[model samples]
Every structure is written in C-alpha cells, then in structure tokens.
Target: MATTVRRTVLTLPAATVGPPNPLPALRPLDETHSLDERARQGLPRDMARQIGYEPLRTLLPVRVLDGYGRERTPTRLDAIVIENERLRATVLPGLGGRIHSLHHKPAGRELLYRNPVFQPADFALNGAWFSGGIEWNIGATGHTTLSCAPLHAALVPAPDGGEMVRLWEWERLRDLPFQVDLWLPADSDFLHVGVRIRNPHERPAPVYWWSNIAVEEHESTRVIAPADEAWHFGYERSLRRVPVPDFQGADRTYPLRSEYPADYFYDVPAEARKWIASLDEGGRGLVQTSTDILRGRKLFLWGSGRGGRRWQDWLTEPGTTGYAEIQAGLARTQLEHIRLDGGEEFSWLESYGALAADAATVHGDDWSAARAEVGSRLSEALPRAAVDAAYEAWRPYADAEPAETLATGSGWGALEVLREGHKLPGTPFDESTLGEEQAPWRELLRTGVFPEPRRVTPPGPSLVAPHWRDMLETAPADPLAEYHLGVAQWHAGDLAQAVRSWERGLELAPSRWPLLRCLAVADQQGGNAERAAERYAEAFDDLCEERRDDGDSWTAATVALGREAIAALLAVRRTAEARDVWSRLRPSVLERGRFRLIDAQLLLAEGRAAEARAVFDAGFEVADLREGAEILGEVWSALTDEPLPDAYDYRMRPQS
Candidate 1:
C-alpha cells in the first residue's frame, strides 16, 4: 500500500536493540506455517522435544514479520499476555527505556520495564516468579482480542533447569490459540505489542485487552492523551468524585484530556489514526492530535497534574497500579457484515519520546545533532530488537483441552461471550449481585500486589443464580469459591445478595472488584447521588482505565450500568434536584457528544423542545449508533418537525 505522506509507510526493516546492535528481523507468518486447531488446544507437539507433556496448543499461532519481510525463527509463541487488545502489540524492538527495578523498599520484589538480557533471564527474578524466561510473539493484528487476550506465558523448557521465559502480565490459563504480534519494523517509529483472533463462528467475539502498569507517583509522572476533556471530569466512568468538572473545551465522543487515575476502555475513532501522546517523557506529559481529515491539520497541547497521581483524585493508594487500555476492533464499522471473515482488523501506532530538556537544560554547539541522533536511534533501536527477538522466538500452540476443560469452575457462565469496546454507561447495579462479572484485578489483589487496599469503587453488572448461592453456603473455607459465589449472585440479579456475599468475601480478601463497583453503584441506587456518583464514576474510570478498543471494558460497563445517577434522576423529571446534583457534578456534558442527546431530552422534559432543538443544533450535533441516535431525530422532528439519524454513525459489529 502506498501513502501520500512520506512517514506513513515505514521502510527500515531490521530490529534495533538498545544502541549499537541490530537483531535479525522476520517475516509475517502465512496460513501454512501458522498453528492448526490440533496445536492450539494444548495438543502435544507433533515432534515432541521434551521429556514430559507439552500442554497448550495453537490453532491460530502467532506469526511474526521482520522489516525485510522474512520469517523469524521458532515461527510463533502461543502463550502470551497483554493489557489493551487494541494495542495487541505494537511492541517495538530492543530494550532502551528498559526499567528493571528490584522492588525491595516496601518489600523484596522485582519489576521489569523494558529489561533486556544484559541481566540475563537466568536469575531468581527477585525471589518472585515475576520475570523469567521472557519472549514476545507479534502477530498481524496490532492488538489483543476478547476471546484471546494477548498471550504472555512462562517459557519453561521441560520445566526442569531449562531456560525460563516469563512475561509479567494478567492472564487466565486457557487452551485457546491467541495470536501474538510485535512491531520492530526496519524504519519503525515506536513499539507495539498486540494480539488477534479471527473466528467468525464465535458470535459476540470480544476484545479482552486493557491498559495497566505498576505505578509510583512522582513529579515527573504525568500522562496526556486525546480524550474527552470531561472524560474523568464531573461524571466520568470512575466513581472518583472530582467533586467538580473543570473541563473547558468543545464536546466530543472522546474528548481530549488527561492526568487522572483512569483505566479507560473506549473505542477507536472510525478513522482510528488519531494521535495521543504521553508525557513524563514516559510519564511526564502527553499530547494528542485528533486529525481533521478535511483540514488535514492537527492541534496539540500538553497535560501535567504536578505529581497528582491522577488528574482527578482517583484516591487510589500509591502502590502497584495498572494504566488505561483498549481491546476491540472498529465493530460499528461495515466489517461486521463480513462472515467468519474475522476481517475486522484494528491497527494503530504509538511513539514514545523523551522530554528534550527545555532550553535551560541544553547547551554546547553539537547538542542538537547529538539529540536528534539519539532520538532517531532511540525511536528506532531497542524497540526493533525487542520485536525482532519476540518474532524470532516464536512457536505455535496446540491445545487438546476441550472447551469444558477451559471453562472456569467458578465463573459466571458455561461460556461467557467476549465483552468488547466500552458499552454505554450502565445502570445502577444491585449490590446484592456483586459477583457475576469477573475482575482482572482479583489475582493482583490476592498476590499481595496490593497489600494496602485503597478507597475506590468499581461499577457494572453483578448477579448470581440459586445453585451458586447454595454452593457458596455449603463450601468450606474456600475464599475462591465464596468470592466467585458473590460474583454469581451479582450476575443472577440479586444485587444486594451479591453484595452481601462479596462483603463476606472482602473480609477474607480485603481486595475485591465487586465490592469496589457494587458498593458504589448501590450507593447510587440507594439515593446518595454524591457518594453514588463518586464511586460510580470511580468504578467506571477504573474499568476504562484497564480497557482498550480491542477490549472495551468501559463500553460493557456502561451497557450493563444503564445511565449515570445524575442522568437517570434527570430522566425522572427531578430536574430541580438533578440540577443541584449536576451543579455538584459539574460534568463536562457540554463536551460529550453522547450526552448532548441527554441535554436535548432534559430540555424537552422541561417543555423546551425549542431549546432541545437548539441543543440538538437543529439536528446537526449527531454522532454514531443509528437506531438509538434516531430517538432525537424523532423528538426533533416533532419539535422543529424535522427528520435526522441520517447524519449519525450508527455502526454495528457482526454477531456470531
């Protein structure tokens, strides 16, 4: 494919490690070389090279490609891990900004950032199995998927004294082959780590990826990206009460703002190449440029909260934490119509830059050239090698395990459909059923990653069926069973019942996601708008914080949630009271194209269809989601007596 821009189509095709080193690059994997079904499900390798059984097979094994379009060694690696499926991996090569910390301050532990093998994968990763034999498996889709989160697994050759390959990530044991991808192209600008799974037969196939990172707050730590300025503003997904909406900008589907404790999971724009930059160098500042295809011009800016953990007071403790992520394709696109085509592919790129040291920092005549070279090399090197090595070290998976075997013994359903990009803000859930949904943080909490629990709420669905409830009561001191039982209650519908169960579970674990969101949503349903709003927003934020378009956590959270407390109250004609809450919330509703529909409704309810029309901009301020968006068209037709919906993006993904 040719591009009008010089930078769009990259040409350099070798991996760059740290600095003066170039690793061999590989070519993309074709169907023949890719793993088959027998391989993906833990089926024994055709040529067993071990003394024991080699579980996990690969039907759709990860395929790697180098800048020169050559296939790397080992072909593919099945076991992998990732955060945002959308970012299935734009994992560049090398390990330059590599950070490997021996976390022994609070306790003795090790953390891996971009660490390469100078430290050798041959050590007791700090007395913990956190980092060991590590490898990367890049695939075609640059992000992870719902059914198949990017696979990051332990590479223990024969489980004996063989080399250990362990990548730090959140994952559940599954016998399915999820493709892994890495981007270490010859002329690459950044690194991407992603995963992809195309199985049209699986309806409601989801993107199960997210954004997460272990964190420690400091002045240099700040994040800036293109998002709704009011995102975490007054009424964001998170229950974290900003107690105010300080957002000031044009409203949009996904406004631009940053510096907050957010784990967001929103969708990629239809024209998904919008720009988002993160600072702190790595965590210092961020700049997002949403390109206007028409004008072809970009506006950029920076964000800094001056060491404030999050733009909004997420109020989460300063320990280990994850970042924001997305995991979904452009579902609402025309691609959904394609059959088992798994044709809906999502692609994007991420570039990391270091603060060029303000004028006060730079000196010397040769500085400019030096900096540029460093930037060029950095922007190139390590990432390339990292991705190259990842690709070169590939192996297809083979799973003989049945679907039943992969099913969670204590999960919500026999087979839960993959959840995708964020759903609309969900309804206030029943605290009783706070156990239905599975949280990505359960293991993180249990593994002592979070020893001191903070004060925050997670939102969304929580139900349980009678069978699970009975089992919970009979189960012995099985915290795992009890906790899941709480989840089942939430999924089954008894919100309060689930909450009680989870409450008990929390007493045992102290760190539960259901308690986080359920308590907050319950608070909302119970009538304390302030507290409810705070926690509800917090939960939403957290969910978003961990989602990627390839894995829209926020969207699902919203779909399950219904509407914001303030919006719901306003819907009930409690305008005056809602106005008060709205004042307290100070939501950047004006900046949210989605909420404009709400404004039109709120105005109409107050007998201001004329005002509503004005709010609808004579039916011009339209967005996506056809049928739903048409409600306004109907209302507007009645008011200005005009028809619309023809101007919205009513996109939809295909069902299994």
Candidate 2:
C-alpha cells in the first residue's frame, strides 16, 4: 500500500470547449401542449411507431418531482472542474453531474470524450439519453431513468485533503439513495471515485448501477479487458463464450466490421478484477477499474457500417462521430444478481485515469503490464489510514436528505446554495424495519426469459441450461430461475422438460401468475391448445384470487398479468373467459393509457370493431397523446385489412 500523503484539493472552472450543437434527434420536444395533444398531432412525417403500445410515461413510475422532459439548457449552465497537478476533470453539475471531460496534462489528451453540445436522444426508457462522458445509471434499466435529467451534486471536504465533487439522488421508484464522490488526488494521475448506495426504504427493492463511460470511437479504438475468455451474444442472439481477442477466427476490435453486429458480453471470471479501457489507436485512452461492487464490465459497439454511422449521427452532432460505452456494474454480470437488504449501505471504490500502452496487444489478464505502463506509482493502493479517513468523512452525506434548495433543482444547483452557508435537512436512516433478505426472484425477473430470436432458435437451453442449473444449485427454490429453466427448455423443443420446470416453479409459488402464463404459452406453442386453455384459465383464476381485493395496491404487473390471461384465453377462443378477466381489471385498464390499448384489443377480438375504433378515438383525451395515438394506430391496423396511414407503416420507422 502506498503511504498516505494528504494534499489540498482545488476546484476550478470548466476548461472544455463550447456547448456543442445539439443533434435533431437529441433535441427536446416542443411541449407547448400535453403529450396527449402532441401525440394526436402525430409524429413528424419521418417518424413511425411499431405494433405495440408506446408507454404513456416514457419511463414507468419515475418520480416526476416537477414535470417530464424538463431539461436545462447546457450552454447556460456552469461547470465545475476538479484537478490535481497531474490531471484535470470537468464535471458538469447540470449534466447528471457527470465527469464531462478528463484531461491528462502530460499527454495533453482528453481522457474522456467531451461532447461539443449537450445532446439527448430518445434512447432511454425515460425518453431522453445523452452521449459522451460518464453517466451514472442507477435504480432502473436503460440508463438510470434520469440520464439526461439533472441530479443533486455538491462539493465534499475530503479528509485526505483533496476537494471532492459529490452527486446524490433519491430514486423514488425504488426508495433508494445513491451518492458518488469523485476526486483527482494531488500528484496522482488516477481519478478516485467512492460510491454509496443506500436502501432507505423499509422493504428491500431491486436496484442496479452502471457507470457508462464513453470515449472517442475511431478505427484505432480497441476495447481491452483482463480476461482471456469472453462471452458474447451475437446478432443471432446466441450467447457464445469465446476467446477474448479472437472469437471464432475473427478479431472483435472496436469500430469492428465483423458480422457480430453489437457486443454485450460479460461472462467474466469470478475472481477477476474487472477493468475495461476504450483505447485510442495510439495506445492511450480512458481506463476504469473498480472493486467487487462493480463486477460486470461491458463494451457496446455501434458497428462500422452505414447503420452504425446513422446511430452515431443520432447521438452526436454533424461531423462529430458517435462513441461506444465501456460500462462497469456492481453485479455478477449485469443487473439483478445481487440485492440490497433494507437499510443496507453498499459502498465501493473505483479508480479512473489515463493509460498509454507500449503495444495495442492489451488483451489477457495482464493488468500488471498496463498498470506498470501508467506509472507504477498510480496503481499503488492507498494507505489504509487515508482510505479509512476519506470513507468516514464522506459517509454522512450519503444519508443527507435533499432540501428544497432550488425547488426541484438537479445537479449542483442546490449544493451551490449550500456552499453559501445554507444547510440542507437530512433525516437519519433508521434500521429498525430493515429486512435481512432482498426481493426473491429479482434477478430472474430483471433478466427476463431467453432472448427471442427472429428466425431459427440458437442451440436452445442445452447450450445455456448448465448456467440455469448452476443458478438452481445456488438457490434451490428460486421461482424465477425455475421459470427461466422452463423457457430454456421450451426453446430447445423439449416440451416435457419445460413442463416439469414450470411445474416446479408453480410448486414453489403456487400463486405466481407469470409462471402459469408462461406454462400456458409453452403449451400453446407446443400444439397442445386444450392444455394451454386449461393453464390459461388457471392463471386467470390465480391472478383474480391474488388481487381479489379491489383495494389491493395496483401496479403495472397486475395490469400486465390481467392482459396476459385475457390474451391467452382468447388465443384458445375462450372469449367468455377473456371477457371475465377484463371485467375484473377494467378499472386498472382504464387508468393507464397503455393498458387501455389492450382493452381495445379485447373489444376487437369480441368483434366490436366500431367500439374499438371509438376507444382509439378517445385517445385525444389521453395525457400522452403521441404514444396513445401510436397504440391507436396499431389497434386500428388489426381491426381492418386497410393499409396504415403513410406515417404508421412499419417500413417507414427509424431504427433506434
């Protein structure tokens, strides 16, 4: 361990270039009217929707403190730059408090890609995601649900002497609090980040974190990892565990021209210390390393062809190319493997800095070589005393409650006010009601069933069954895992094995409507329509029994389960059963626009075409008119043989 040598931390102004021009795709929509009105007005002539219901809320269950799509103009926002003698970091307190840019003084290179403009695209479940910089994705999937929005940020006094930028957010949906403290210690090139994720709720909830770091994507850009073997899901949806450098005799380098399409691999060794670098052709680029809290290191590619180029253009300004993400997560592979107990405060440390390799053959588990090349001094572990001191001083802010500093202000807006002698109110976290175990079957639910391939299936569960079997060994009665095992078996055309898995899951949790639905679907797909009908009826009955009380807390799960039961029943021509299911859940179906579309679907199935058309016409009154109209179009197409309007044609849709 390196000896402790505390130095004063200095905060400076932003030194990066102009607020870059925003891409059309990233531009915020004109919100003069409600979403319902805009949707009725319809999307631009160039845009087209798909066959399913576009979500009413861009991201479900997001705590809309103020309003949706309330984005701050980047150019007008101020930035805070934290630096040491060796490195300078530009943090945009407005841009999710992200490390907007990192510059290594010696190399005079931007270790982190700095976007010229703050551009947000419709890539996130929240309806807005920006390119460039390190984005902290927490709580939900698809970019934290607040990627483009601002987060609360402040400057923390580090006990080790450097000034640290602290960013915190209270994720409402999951009732959890997450805080990140970033600092560039004096005389060190490495940027140290300490993270604290606390479940402030009384019940354990599902939470995930992904530090998405983007670097310049060029022909020379190569992704480096410390693993000899790599697992990747090819475009064909087959999860293949292959060599790191060469996968089936092809080099899977960045800006790749191979047929792999997009890369999302994370079958890393358990003991391996996860690190990924988006290296420039010249052997220098951004590098991120973390402790076991972040076990999954991922690299996403946009490809090298025109399709890739168009996606790049969507994220970046004209002439400015798109970049790839080198993400690190705190789970075994991705989200859902680990769960936090109520009132549990999980903390981890991560180090980021610039790295230059003598050669680009930076594959294999030789991190020592890369560490040595970056200056052996940079990789030395901090003295236990200094690390302890730093962790202690910064721990209080993790539980610091947000005050009404800026009236729903995000980023460092409120923190800046606190610096002016105003103290924010913080409630002490109570552990009295804390639970020992997190939500069961969270991992299986989060990962969902197997990937649905377009044409022929992959080697099916036989190739991946061992992985599920391994999970079963770890958690013998995990209903979700058992359900996934059934999915894998069904994909392999083993109806008997699939049925047994489903039966096991049901035995563990008899009221699991989802498992029953899955079993019913499997039977239907296996040409056993009568059996499928029986299973569907059973699932519908279970759903009704579970939520028999009208006052039961309703969620999307309830709505979805009801719809699924109805669909399964209708598939087997059980119209009366479908209607009965709908009658029971109609109130919920009417409450959410997305589910209303399903109601219209049932109406169409019942031969009430005029009523279904009227249901869609009623979309004009919906809050998110745009999404409502899209669902209306999908349902309209199903009710008639008539070709969709020019705008609703699937071929006219732009690829996301």
Candidate 3:
C-alpha cells in the first residue's frame, strides 16, 4: 500500500463560478403579529420598563440576508469564492459576512455545515438568528443580537501571504468596534481568523465574544478538547458542574448518541492549548484553534430523540439535519462578563482547518500533527512550536475556578443519563413550555451589581400614554401593549389608570403574575399599603409555585418577579413575609451570588450594620461576587462611619 501525498498552492478569487442558489422567502412578522412570546402571556411591568416602555423591534428589516423572514425585495448578491489549489471556500459578504462553504479538495468534503437555504429562527438574544456556518458573536452574549445582520466585508492582502477577507462591524449596543480577518494561504489547509475588539467610549463597557461554529452531527462524530471539567449552564445562565468528555461517569464522546439534549461549557486546563476538533468516522473533520485570550469551549446537542427532532424543526427548516455547536469564548464563560477599560482594545487569533487522522480521539498534541498532515509545507512555514510557545507565554489575567459544581446536571434531562452511559428518554420543550426567556441578570440584580430602579415619580411631561394606547388599539390582545400603557400611566401619575391598564393585561393572561407584581407597585405608590403587600405576597407565592414545579431558579423573569414582590414587602414593612421569600431562595442565592446582596439588605433593614458589612466582605472574596462587594461597599460606607477598604474602591482580584 502506498501513502497518498497531497500538495497545492494558493489561488486567486475566481471571477466566474457556478450559478447561485435561489433565495427562499420566509413570512415576516407584522404589526398584528409579534415575535415576543411574553406579549401573549401578559407582559410584566418591570420587563416593560427594562425595555424602555417602548415597542420592541423583534425581527430584522426585510431585504437583508437573502430577504428571508421579512417582506423585502430580494437583491441579487454575489458569493465571493476564495480558492487555493487544495482548498476552496465561499463567503457571503452581504449576509453577516460568514463563510458559506469550506471544501477540502482532496477528499471533496464540506468542512462546515452549509445550509442550503437561508432561514432565520427566533433563537438569539435578538429574536432572529440563522443556522449554519460560523456566526461571530461579539458584545452581549448568547448568539449575538447581530447574528442575522449584515456586516461590512472586504478583501485585503494578508501582510504575510495570500488574500484575507475582513469583516468589520460597529456594535451599537455596547458601543464597541469589532473586526474579524480571515486568511487562507495557498500552501496551508487552515483558515486563520484574527479578531480585534475595541471599546472606544469614554466609559468602561462589558465585553463578550464567542465564535459559534456549526458542523453536521454524525453518528460516529466525536469532539476532542483538552479539558478536565465542564461548566454547564441552561437557558437561564445557571452554571452546572459536570465532567467534560465524561458525563455521568460515562465518557460521552461527540456526535453524542444520547437521545437527551445537552449543552456544556468546558473550562480547559490552565496550561492546555486552546483547540477543539470534531472527528468523523474516518477520523477526518474540522478543527478550531485559538490563543488563550479565547479560553472557553462549549458543546451543544439537539439530541436524537423524537423531542430532539421537533426541536430541530422548531429551530431550522424541515429538511435541515441536526448539528452541533462547538463554540469558543473570550472569557471564563459567556455568563462571566468581563470589563474592558474605556478606549482599550483587545485582539486574538483563531484558526479553522480540515485534517485527517487515523486515531479515534484527537488530543492537544494531535493538533500539531493535524496541521502538519493538512499541509506539511504550510506547517513548516508557520512553525507550530514557535506559535504554541508564544501563546504559552502571555496569559490574560482572569479569575477562574476548578469545575465549580454550580448545578447538578444539564438542564435538558435526568442525571441518570450521565451515569448510565446512555441518553435518557424525554421530549424537547416547545416555546409555550419554555416560559419567559430573559437575559441572565438575576445575579446582577440580586447582588446589587445593577442598581434597583428608583421609586416611581409623578409621570413627567414626556409621558407616552397616547403612544401605548394607540399600540393597544392596534394590538388589542397584545399584553405588552397593555402593560406599557399602564407603565406610561403610572409615570404620568394616573395611579387609577395605571392600575386599570395592568389589571386589563392580567385579565387577558391571568398566568402573568408579573402583572400582579407591577400592580402592587402601582398600589404602593398610590397609597394602598395593605393592598400592595397582599398583591406582593400573592406574586411571590405564584412565582414559588412555578419554580417549585419546574425545579429551577435560573429564570430571570421569575427572579425579577420575586425580587419585586420582596422589595414591595420590605417597603410595606412585611418583614416576616420578605424573610420567608428569602429563606426559600437562600440556597440558590448563596450559590448564585445575587441573593447575598438581598441578605445584606435584610440585615441592614434590621439595624445589623456589622452583619451586613460581613456579608459584603465575604462575598467580595469570591471572584464572581466581586461586583456585588463593590456595590455593598458603597452602601456600607454611606451608612456607617467606617469606610470599606481601598480594595473595594477599585476592581482587584484577591491574590489567589
């Protein structure tokens, strides 16, 4: 038997190629229809306030990204195909500037999952997101709100060799600028992607970045990453402790045969190289490598059960098959938000390549061999050892933990699946069953990382009751519209009108206990002290019922509801009831960090200043709770003659 050898050089962009596929049209949501699930469930008062009491732009405008999911004329766009002798890749510059297809010429294999048609689903932090290819998530978290938006892309010459595609976008939400440069040298089988993020604002900003790579989920596929433990979290950002590669005492390899849904975020060994690869039955697949700046990796599974099929249908087109997400993050994990100093710019490099190996499982050292196997000439030119040495030298300063067992098991199924070496049988949840999906801010709220909203003042002259009222007229069944009207009325000082609006929202969706919480707020401000406390207690009980039935406290909306109820109880001097609520959530609060702030508040309410200070002091010791400490420090300093140490004055990670 003779060993097959391959060789090729870089090629230029082809002016003429095959014809493009037809863009499919998807129904877009109109004013009569809303992408918001909460609107139908009765919008909560606090959520309405969080959203600025204004209507949400749930879907992207039409004519963007092949005009899918919106009513817009389809514009003809050209796909830029960058090819070398051994590899050919196509990028759609107009469509989020994603790599549409990557093909390894020798094996004639598609390295990345190529969605045949463009389809947007309601899965992102923003309402719309597209599956397939690699989506760049920068600023905010969970599939960036801009996943479906178009990006500025241009072809530029690489300083080293060959041409590179540069995708740049100014993230409006975080007021940060982000750019991704992709290079494919002719002699190398790898595609180098370099990313740079900048906070040009005067004030500091929270930063998050993740590269979501989609690959076909095959029966024999396995994912390999150098990590001992995984930090798993559910939709609500509740981190769970589980073994990476191993789940439930069983080694659950990739292309997981388990029929249960799974999502795990792995924190690799501190000194391990950052790389994850998905291997096919023949040990050939896509490998992604990055510097230590991007330190986390995530594995997501849609499962292979009946429920899993339904989830697939819900998230993508009918014919599209199941896929796995191998994501790389820039921080400890997505939920652990990082702060970038004003005007500070951070940059990192990531590489994606296709390689074949004979081993069933690939390891850290395998990456070097894989690179060499892909292209010996390119491997020699790049010199893997030198690059690895450089990455080892510069480690970013970050607070980390060793597999904090935050939660028991993956939220998708039973813990038995982890131990039994097989996926547990269950059905995937539908949208209605999923319940209020809000961004993760429970810890921030509970820990005082985010300041509570001020008491409602008399509605200012800028009150927008008419605006909300008009929306209600158009969307009579829209609970959000009705809720917003109440908010506007409350701000406008029409206590009775505000109460009526919220009541109407509840009447439409009685399950919306959040409306009750809001109504209690209005009642308190309206001088109905006893009624306010009653409503607050009722809201608290309702949330507890739901949480108890679900066995999860990670729901932000529920937390917000409970927080409001407790705050209202405290305001009305119902200390006993507030204590009961706090008692129920004590364990979760302690595990999550936010509730500790509430505990401190309760102590202070009881005139235990020293105890309150101790609570803050203790929390400040944990890396995750440092922000909570700072907020408490401010309060402690204001209330007591004794000031918090200077350590609280600045962001300092206690010397480990």
Candidate 4:
C-alpha cells in the first residue's frame, strides 16, 4: 500500500473561478434548504420524477439531515445565462479539491454513499448531487469487488450562455481512486463542450478510473450505448459471470437492453431513440451522448456482483429488464487503470437515454397524442446543430471497427482457461496458486455430481458409493473424494450414477451445500419441484453458514441464498405463511442497505407502474446498479402476473 498522506482532503476554490452556490442551492422547484429545515418542512422532491409525485415520495425513504456533513462551501459562479430565472445558467468553478460526500440525512433510495475512499465505512444516503460509488480495480478483490458508485464529480460550466450540463472530474483519494467524471454536455442545443484536467501534483500519477452515472428515466431504464460494436465476450448469464471482451473491428454500436437473459455484447446503432424529454426553457432535445473510456484508456464497467440476493437473476426474463449500463471502465478481474503519475486525469465518454416514448405501455402503437400535446413547445432548448455535430464526432469513433484481439492458448488446450485455477468471486481459491487438489476439482467440472471427496477440496470426506469401482485408489485418502467422482459421472448424463454418489456422500456427510445444490438441480431436472425446493433449502442454509466469514459474499451488494430461499417459499404460493420466515432473515433485503431491491420488488407487486418507476429511479438516485434490466423484469413480471424465476435458465427456457 502507498504511504500517501491526506495531502488535501477536498479543496474547492470557487473564489478564483466564480461564486459557488452549494446544493439544494435554493431554487424555485428544488431548494438548498438545510437538511434539518427540509426535514421539519417535509420538502417535496421532483428532480428525477415525472409521473406520480406522491408515490415517488414514499418510494425514497431517505433520512434528510439538518445540514450536510462537514465540508467546504461550494464556489458559486455567476449565472452567465440569466436571461430569465427559468432560463438561466449558474456556473461554479475552482473546485480543484472539494471532496463531496453523501450525508446520512435525506436518506433517499438513491443516496447509497456514506463516505469517500477516505472514509470507507460510513455508507451515505442515496440521491443528492454527488453519489460516491467510485470504480475500483478488478483484482482489488480478485475481480469480485466492483466500483459501482461515485466519490465526487465536477459539473463543468458551459462556455455558451447555456445550462452547465457537462461534468468532468472525480474523487481524488490516494486509496480506492478514480479521478474523472465523464458526462456529456447538458446544454448541447447551444454549443460545443469540453473540460480541462488540473493536475496540480509535480509527478505524473497513475489513476484507474471511470464515471458512475445515472441517466434520466422514462418508459424504461433500458439504454442503447456503444463501446465498440465489434466487441465479443465470454458471457454466462446464469452464473453471474461477466462477458470477457474479444474486440475484432474498429467500431460497433451495441444496443444493450434487459429484454432476456443476455450476457453477450451486441452493436449500438447510430440512430437515437427519442427519449422521454423534459420540456425545459428551450424545448425537447435528443442530446444524450453515452460513451466510455475503454477505447482510449484502460477502463471497464463491471456488473455489480454483490448487493445480496445471490446476485440472483431476479429481473432477467424477457421484456422485463431495463437499462443500458455501459462499462468501459475495467474487467471484473483486472486493473481498471494505472495513472502514469499523481497528476494525470482520464475521462470516459457519455450516453443519453431516450426520453421520447413512441407509444404508451398500454397502447404500444403510436405517439400521436403525446406528440401533439407538446409538439413545438421548447425548440430553443435543443441545439440540433450541436447534437448533429456530436453524433458526427462520435461517428468516426462509434462506427470504427473493434480492436482486434487474438485468443491465447496453453499446451493443456485452449479450453484450459476453464480450469480450477480460474478464480471467481466465491470460488474460495487462489488464482495464482495451484494446489494439489486440482484433479478432483476438475472432476467436479467433468461431472455434475459432487466429488467423492465431499467438499471441493482434496483433503475432504471420501464417501464411497455403490459405483466406487469406477474410482481409482490414491495413496492419500479424501473424506469427500467419492462425491467429486460421482458429480463427474452425473454431468456426463449418468443420473443414476449421480444419485448413487449423492446417497453415498450423504452417508458420510449428511449436510453440504454443494451436494444439496447438485441434489436440488437434479431434482429440478427430474421435474420434482417439491423435492428440489426442500433440498435447495438445506443447500441455501449450508452455503450461508459457509460464507459467513466471506463479507463480500453476503454484502448488501449481493443476494444471499437464504433470501432466495425465503422468496422461493413465497413463490411456491406459501404467501402469508412464508412471510414469517422472510421477516426473520429480512435484514439484508428489508433493513437499511444500499439500493432498495426489496422496495422495488414490493412496488412491482402492487401493480403500480409509475410507483415502480419511481422506485427504480430513486434507487438509482445514488448508484446505477447497472440494473435497468432487473428493475424492468420485476415490474414487467409483477404487471403480467408472472412470478419471474430466480435463475437465468428459467428466464430463457420456452414458456408454457
């Protein structure tokens, strides 16, 4: 670890640039009332809202404080475009080192940050100006840890007397670092936009970074952002593994929507979907620019694998998911970035989600009525010429061919990457260290049944089965060695043999998660829902205990099996009866956590579409879970009365 001191926590020098009007910066619609006064007065919020304002209030159960946490005042810039109060632009510059943090008060669903890298424990409330979900290197925790939120951001003032829309800067922390906010110009209907990086340090600094952004919501949060169209990946939707890239051409626009169980990358189109637009001072504008830093810098986006619920595919079914979370930041298990010196700054590109809903969710045919309602209201708001130019500027980059990458191989075979050494989040193994227990480990892969050596480890239980003759004897004995051999046999389509293995393993070690997982799978495969659920319950309990020591495993970021177990019970129509069990293990899903998944689920169940959207919108108010898909799935399923399955196979399989 670097012995770097907190040279400057966060210094905002608004005096040099312009006067700063700090947030909730007292305004007409949104005001900068102190947290306590807002609480006393019960401030009504409508920032990310469009539909039901009342439902939206309950959607975000945040705790607003009297004042923001201890921090410097914002540098208030003069309103350059004070043509009118409604059509004015206020700019605040010289925030060279002002560290913005989330306050505990005003606890909205979106205020999911507690502190910056400087303070890693004080989780913040979601929503507010700067949500502190910054990106970290993949190997920081061996590809399991994800940089999902933001630490700080800089909303740059537009040169034109337009709305200061573009932001460029990031949280400056010596540890857990990212140093840039890469967003597009908000006042694009006016002029060209750009930002300057002020590297004050003497030496060049290597900083790994990316932007944690939340676009305006609409009919759906699903987006169409492009990294490079020609990018390919190793995507396994069910196991929660991200797609590893295989770029081939220059540019490829990928249309990423959470319609089905997708783990692959597709191309983004040059055409932009008319998004749900805000009729502002000028008018409706299609000026969203979504881009990433991967093309030029070493950055990537990782799907959040934590946040409880086993990182379950709760919202993965067809036509249910939403959002196009573009991750050109870092791979799940690699360096996100390496700043050459202490003063270098790298920024990713931008993307705009479509606010132009073509048809009503109920009608799905035409936008004639809605279009006519506000046809030419704010033409001045859109800078068509600038938007066109941005599209053109991004064209050379967006439409370029993907970067060509050759697949590497080892003598053991190209498929060797799927070996036991291939480390993952919960594998409980070292990636660089290859231990003696690899044979049986591979055997588990070969067979679907548990290895004879009970646990995946080598020096485990050795439960001999009826088909023990197939096993070769080794000098050293393993307790669960018999289990691995059985699993390998089962995966090869020998269920009878797999059953024999499980029975034998049970004789030695009656309760085990892996075995029960296999048993539940086997039962499901055999069409025994009752038995599968029963065994899965046991597996869920065992796995929970096993992962007790692994904080990340059960972090508020990933879902736990016990949670799934409770949900599964409810899904079986146990309903009220199941609520009791659910309430007991409900801290992860119920008690305070990061994003409000349970709240989203509940809203969906109540058949409140607008409320559901508000839930998702507020949940993303702090950090974008890259979960537009899940949010859509929950609502879509709840509306259609389809209890979405917990797994991807269920999402992809043919419907009855």
Candidate 3: what lDDT? 0.53
Model 4 poorest 10 in a row by lDDT: 18-27
Worst 10 residues of 1 by lDDT: 120-129
Tens-digit per-residue lDDT, 1-656, candidate 3: 11111112223221111111111011122321122334323333432232232232222111112112221233344455667766777766555666777888877889887765554544555345667888888755455656655555554445343445566655643545566766666565666677777665557776778888888887777776666677654333234567656566545555456555556767676676677777777777887777777888877765565445544544444676677878898765554446788867677777777856665324323443533343343244344563454233221201111111111111111111121223111111112221111111121223323222233111111113233244333444445445555655554446687678778888775345556776876676578888988887887676566543322222434444555567777887787788777777645444444466677777777778889878767754221222112454556665676755543432211211
* Candidate of highest lDDT: 2
Model 2 alpha-carbon miss at residue 94, Å: 2.5
Candidate 3: Cα lDDT at 580: 78
Point out the higher-scoring one by lDDT: 1 or 3: 3
Candidate 2 vs 3: which has more lDDT = 2
After superposition, candidate 2 runs with Cα above 4 Å error: 1-59, 63-74, 234-238, 259-261, 335-337, 360-656
Clashes of 1: 195
Per-prediction TM-score, please? 0.30, 0.53, 0.50, 0.30
* Candidate order by decreasing TM-score: 2, 3, 4, 1
Tens-place lDDT per residue, model 4, 47-109, is: 112111111111011111111121224433211111121121112122222212211111221
lDDT of 4: 0.30
lDDT of 2 by residue, 613-653 (tens): 77766652222222112454566778776754432321212
| Model 1 agreement with the true structure over 1-656: per-residue lDDT tens digits | 11011101112222111110011001111111122343334422321212012221221111111111111122221212211211112121122111122121121222212222121110110100111111221222111212111222322221111222222221121212232222222232222333333332223223322122222223333222222221121112121211111333411111134432222222223443333322232222222121122111111111222222221112111242322221122221111111222434222222221222232212213433423333333333334344334333322211111111101122221112222221111111112322433442232223422112232222322223243345455655343455555555544456687567656765665334334455655565566666655554454444444433422233333322323534645544566544443333224333345456666666776787778777766454322222112354456566663434344322111112
Q: What is the C-alpha lDDT of each candidate?
A: 0.29, 0.54, 0.53, 0.30
